[model samples]
Target: MTTDLVVNILRHMLEQAMLISAPVLIAAALISFLLSLAQTLTSLQEQTFTTVPRLLLVGTLILIGLPWFARRMVEYTVHMFTDLHRYLG
Candidate 1:
């Protein structure tokens, strides 16, 4: 494949990665922020305070979003495979 093809694939991979991770990251960020606020209010300066809540929230988000993520991934995979001939030749 040419440099342009490689770059295009890399860009697509990055975009897909960002799309898949955005929900989880956003959920984690919100939970972490809230946890931090609570900790600050209570004067409970526990470094690990945000870990469990963030993890749980992100896990729940991942579970809820799994089907949609899988569908999108499969669509991208099929598209890439269908267009493989263009790159391979």
Candidate 2:
């Protein structure tokens, strides 16, 4: 295992993680912003108002995106394993 190989592996892992997480994170953030805006407009400051919807939306996004996420993860795992021999030297 060389330094370059380790660095590359780490980089790929992080990239994959970011790619998989970005959609849900982005959706959550957008929903949070919209909820905040609604709260401000309506003077409704209930914590659940923001938290519940965000959670639901995020959950839904994860469920909807699960297949794509799984595929990406599987591909990453396969790629790492397939290239394991190259790093073993």
Candidate 3:
């Protein structure tokens, strides 16, 4: 593939990756912030206390969004493969 095509593919891959991860990352960040606030207010600094909630929240979010995530990945793969001929000599 030419440099332009390669760069475009790489950019698309990164964009897809970011889009896929954004929800999980954002949910975790918001949960963590809320947990931190609770910990401060209660003076309860146990590591597991914060850890479990964070994991649970993120896990729940991922599970709920699994279909959407899978669809996005499949769409990306199909798109790349469908356009593969353009990159092949």
Tens digit of per-residue lDDT, candidate 2, span 1-89: 87988999999999999999999999999999999999999999899999889989999999999999999999999998999889886
lDDT value, candidate 2, whole model? 0.94
RMSD of each: 1.3, 0.7, 0.8
**Model 3, 4-70: lDDT tens per residue?**
9899999999999999999999989998999999999999989999999999998999999999999
Question: How accurate locally, in lDDT, is each candidate?
Answer: 0.89, 0.94, 0.94
Candidate 3 ranges beyond 4 A from true positions: none
TM-score of model 2 (CA atoms): 0.97
Please report, as a residue range, the 10-residue window in candidate 1 with the lowest summed lDDT. 47-56
Q: Report clashes for each candidate as comma-separated counts.
A: 0, 0, 0
lDDT of predicted model 3: 0.94
